[model samples]
Target chain A: MAAAAERRPVWMRAMIYGFVATWFILAAFPFIWTVWGSFKVELDFFSIADWTYALTGERTKAEYGSAFTDAGYRGAWIQEEFYRNFFNTAIVCFFVVCTSLTIGTLGGYALSRSSYNYTFWLLITALIFRAMPPVTLVAGYLLPFFQWNLWGHLATTIIVLVAINQPFTLWMLHSFFKKIPQELDESAKVDGCTQFQAFRHVIIPVMWPGVITTGLFSFLLAYNDFVVTSMLLEEKNRTMVPQIAAFLGTTYTEGNVMFAVAAVVSATVPLFILVMFFQRQIVSGLTAGAVKG
Target chain B: MKHRTFFWFFLPTAIAMLLFIAAPIVSVLIQSVFAPHEAVLIEVENCTPLVGCTTETMIDQEATRDLREAQPLGRFVGLDIYLDRAHLAIEEVGQIWSTSETWGSFWSRIFNLPFYRAMSFTLTYTFVVTPALIVLGLMIALAVNSLHRHLKGLMIFFSLLPMIVTPIIGSLILFWMVDSRGVLGSALVSLAGDPNFSLKASTGLTWVMLIIYGIWSSAPFAFVVFYAGLQTLPRDTLEAAQIDGATRWQQVRYVIIPHLTPLVTFVALIQLMDNFRVLEPIIGFNASAHATSLSWIILNDLGGETRQLSSASANSVLTLIGVAILLSPVLVRTWQDFKRKT
Candidate 1:
């Protein structure tokens, strides 16, 4: 009787399994299908006569004399110079993460340690800034950028992204810093250290875990950004995301949809690897604010 | 920390935020109320040999260039841009209000205007997606929690894909599959028993598709949060319910849900703000004909050969107001919390 009560009924077990299976497919199937389809000719990938052609790649076999081909990858990476955009993305993400974290740590540390009321107001101000849509801010930037001859440059976009990233970065690091005991730094101050020295010697070394987590988010923001990059960067300096968007405009007309597909797959690879390694950090970062609040 | 010390530490970030975030907002405000100077017009009398002199109004190119170069911020027009047809469309709304007999007709007529159309979709998407994602996330969290330990990690890894991938890429992947020639699109066509069926062709179905995409991409965030919340559940309370002969449903209803209520609100608040800025998915899906968002409208206005800076700025100001309204409750609650702490 105890065993019977402990175990779920057969129907209940089956229901749970069925639901999980559906969600698993819902989450995973699209990417798997697209990656598989990306190797084939457009005809086979988007086959109207038979869907199985996508899986079997019948036209691809006939055209390329093999089941798989890298024609799309060749066109995107070579002919279209996607590597330039990839390089631009790398540069932007690197600088944005470094600059945002440096300033964010200082500000966030101050916000956490200060016992003043203005710190509270500053945080509230950051929260309001965080909620404003990036596009709305872009409207304000155009006139000034054009006037100052700063439009369509990587440096301008990177600085703007860092500033936009500041609010969230500051908030996340502020919360993380709050968890660190104030006594660690206070004792350093007692031991004949200035405030900056205490922060540099005592707090900085222990802040890596929180900083790394915050850095991952900053990297993602810069990497996955579309609006800012698309609006601010020139055609030659476009990042992976805006480049992919640009691909769609031309690819659709030229019957080169597979190039866009391949480019998207290429763009997703680094993120895929990032999640694989930093899954724990990502999960924890997401819950940090929610759990505490 | 001393005030001077704190000031030095906070200066870099404060400068960044002030110049980029705060200044742009001020710029948007100023831009919204101003219009670019009209090309300086001059009237000239032209006479051809066989025709009488005719006074012709022509754009004075030299003067226009000088004017624009001198005052690059444009001429101040007060609130005219905000009231234009592309934005708030006050005159259009008034006409629709007076002419339409029923509430439904009035609403339909008003929605035909671009700004109202974008607002309706943005609001509907926000309100619908936030709650729906929370519910779906809870269900997934509960179900995944019941699975074997080994399978749990694998499920989470796969689940994070939709959320972690670039928004445009994820939407494009889904959009391709739902194209009329693609697999799901074909299956949908067959299911509906119509050869011409396409998800992108209808406004209602396009919205439903986008809403589904919204839930799919965001449900993982909620799930991860709720699942973490579930791990911290008090085991003794569950055992107490079990000893009381509480069925599984009753345990979930009475014990589990009450514990997870705070988490639900957290997820709802975060998702609301994120969904209100839905633009990339619309672009990825290429469904702007059927659906438009406030962010998308702003982007469209700012793009093209002639950048309509004034119009876009007005839309930006309006969007900011909407965000402020949506955010007031959070702010008020935060203030109360601060008061309590003090």
Candidate 2:
């Protein structure tokens, strides 16, 4: 009877494991497929079965040469307009990340070391900014950016992207900064440190995790951004995602393999690197920064 | 708490923010009314007591010449665009209300059936997806919370991997998996005895796939939030429920539900905000798949040569208004809930 009872619980545990495993499979299957698909040759991918098969097979020399070499480069260059678009997106993300992170960290520090009302106001303001949709200003505001040359510059796109993403970065780092005790700031100030000095030396060291989390998010956002990038970037200055779309049109018949290859390479790799690098802080960062931001 | 210290601490951020973040947003608001032709202008004065002062504004005379150059050089149209768009919007409403067309007619063809249809569909998608995410997230949290320590950490990380993966990649995976010969399709056909398991074409199947894909991609983050909230929950109340002879359902209903409400509200509110901005899945899926989202509409409107900047902007502004309408209540309620907690 005792053995039978024990078997029931063990069986239940196995069922739970199975259920959880299924969920993970559903969540993870695409990433796994994309990684493999990235490496697949043009012909093999056309009628590819079980997306994961791309992972196990070696790419033919021609396929390998095309994906990495000038053949692939020339094909993608004309087909997708990728060479130009990649730079557009990289420039946008670079400036957006740098501007937003700098502003957010400074603002986050103020909110942390400051009074309750400041924190409250900052939180509310950031929340409102967080909730504010990009589509809202797309016409009434951003239209002028395209209409006027000043607003059409690469700088304008960066400025807008930075503004749009700042609230979340600020909110994320604010919460993280708040978690650090005030005692450290007080002692640093007591050690003849100016407020900026204390912030630069002591607070920054302790808040590296928070800074990293915010930076990673800012980077991902700028990297993965589509709407504003699509809207603001002109024909000459199309971004990476748009470049990928342009690839689809250019490579309509035989280009799927190239697109699949580029799509796999450009879209998935940075994200994988991000998760791998910030594996520990990423979960907390996203939950705290992104969802809440 | 000293006023001086507050000023000093807040001033740097306030200044930087005012210049960068706040200035641009304010400028947007200002331009929403003023509709400025130029972004900013700088004037240089080299006074030689003789005759010399020159002003250079960053205005691109060449670009503005075609549109509104007839007006005073530096003057704005002053809400003419807003008023025009508003009129256009009302006409759009009247047409949609009165039309018998499958997609609704637009008073101005610019605000046609497809536009409104896409808007409604996007809203419905958000409405459906957000609550499902909240409830499913809570379930995952409860399940994860029930796990032993080491297993719990591993499980959380596993769940989170999806959240870490880009949504574009996530959608692509779904695209492949539901392709007729993919593993998921084969599994479905074998189980249900229907060989033609079409995830792309059929509406019911498409929605099911979208929701499942959305939940799968998003629930990890939600789970983390709910799990964090669960950790912070006071234990004594749950223990007391057990002591009072509460059944499992009763303990959860009476105790856990109340405690979890704030997290639920936060999750739902954030989901409401983010999901409306969703552009990736539709973009990745492409139009051949019959996926029409509001973001896609805005993207397409601005993407082409007809280049209807005003209409596209109006469309985005409308989406913003819609989001504000749906979300402000949630924000206020969440704020109140948080205040109560503090």
Candidate 3:
């Protein structure tokens, strides 16, 4: 009995350490896999542990240089294609996030300050729109686009993306704006500041963190969205996801590995940036959104 | 000055929403019913009609004739579609309900066997997945709530990872993991020494896969909310209960659970609404074959080769109705809770 009691504390401590280590491993696997796979050459991707173990076993620097320089090779062509996909993703995400914030923030503010009878209804409608299944209306939009000669247009794609994301951005901003306290607005008015001026100078600064958090969320959503982009874009203008899907769906020997690498590269960048830049805001904002009251 | 100021400040937002969001939704509702009425199929006889009019009308048979073509699709024929389908019954005498159509093929889907089945499956899916998420999420929140401060941040971040990743990317990862020769499959073999356990074996496995996958994606979200609520919960209430000689179970039953009723209801409402409308995982799992949920069924019906626009509208209307019916009570309760809090 005495011997068992002496060992219990040490055993419990070891168990806790094991549990913590396992939790960390499980959580970080996707991020680590993505980064490692992104840097790995195609052939080594799916060999699993072998790929990591044999990192220095059979490589030549001359071949690596030639692989980049070879003008006629299909592999080199695909490498260039990825560069284009990455650029497209960046441009689309940039515009979508900026536009949604500008429009959604204005809309959220109006809904917040207004005494309109349907403001709550409008907010609810917006939430429903955001939550509406994307697949339901995507095909409907495609039919119109095809008939109207608007197929393959970036504007159409952006509109659909904006529509999908606007509700949430508006919702988040609404919650944030609501939290600024009415007393702040009242005090500003007493100080001879016009409502607009008070909003610009006072409320906007107080809510800047919330805006950034909402912006990050919107940016990540637009960057990572595959369905609307895939449905809207043709092969020539395909985005990052469809591009990766093409490689992943390929039948070549090196296809799986290359795909894993590409997938890792494309999805991980924004996620890492988010984690690094707005860790606290993202966490707390999500928490607030979750617990409604 | 205050009244005038409020009006001026609110005008831009109100106008923008009225134009963009309010306008589009109204248009969608209109398109669902009346907008489609503009298309009508017109059939015309050509110059020197061959069968019936050739003998009587064609002395100058060289006369050219014109015929107006009907609209190719999407014509609204009214409530004829809804009523005719509601009147259909089982084919007991091998009549197969043929040639008795009051409206058309599109109208018949209201009583269509597949439609009801899909609705049932959707309800079942929503029912199963929502509770699973709430339970798993609450457990995670409770577990994490018990953690020390330094470890709490790390765990919270980990919990939030799934929500941060794109659904498409996460689905793809899940796809790869569940592949027969992939990481998940291999892990099962290593742990249980069974190589034949594959998710692709049946429709049930597909359902299982989707449910678990959803739980994975959503549990983190629930956890974060509940955790935040847990953190802000009044400590004195629980302390008082403990001081009164309440057991752990009694303290939790009387103090913690009741205190968390608002959060619980809020999470439940959100999860229910969200899960009811989930489309991605089902689509990824192949919504057409095997098991079909309401969203997937509606999507398929929308995209079917017949180009049945009215049927699609009807299906969506049914979905919207179903959602309203299912969510109304919870929504009312939440509204009441919000009222109390405010």
Give the number of the best model, judged by DockQ.
1
- Candidate 1 has a TM-score of 0.98
Estimated TM-score for each candidate = 0.98, 0.77, 0.76
C-alpha displacement of A187 in model 1, angstroms? Answer: 1.1
Lowest summed-lDDT stretch of 10 residues in model 2 chain A? A44-53
Model 3 stretches with alpha carbons more than 4 Å out: A1-26, A30-77, A115-118, A143-151, A242-257, A290-292, B1-73, B79-121, B189-197, B283-288, B297-312, B334-342
Give the per-residue Cα lDDT of candidate 3 at B100. Answer: 45
Clashing residue pairs in candidate 1 are none
| Tens digit per residue, CA lDDT, model 3, A94-190 | 8888877887776677667766555666776765665455545554565456667877766667766776777788788888887778888779989
Ranking by DockQ: 1, 2, 3
lDDT of 3 by residue, B58-138 (tens): 333222211112332345555543333321123411243454455554344432566655665677678887788777677
Q: Mind sharing the TM-score for model 3?
A: 0.76
Place model 2 in a CAPRI quality band.
acceptable
Worst 10 residues of 2 chain B by lDDT: B103-112
lDDT string, candidate 2, B1-78, tens digits: 345655665565456445545554554454444443453344555566668776655655555664455542234565
User: Model 1, which residues run further than 4 Å from truth?
Assistant: A1-6
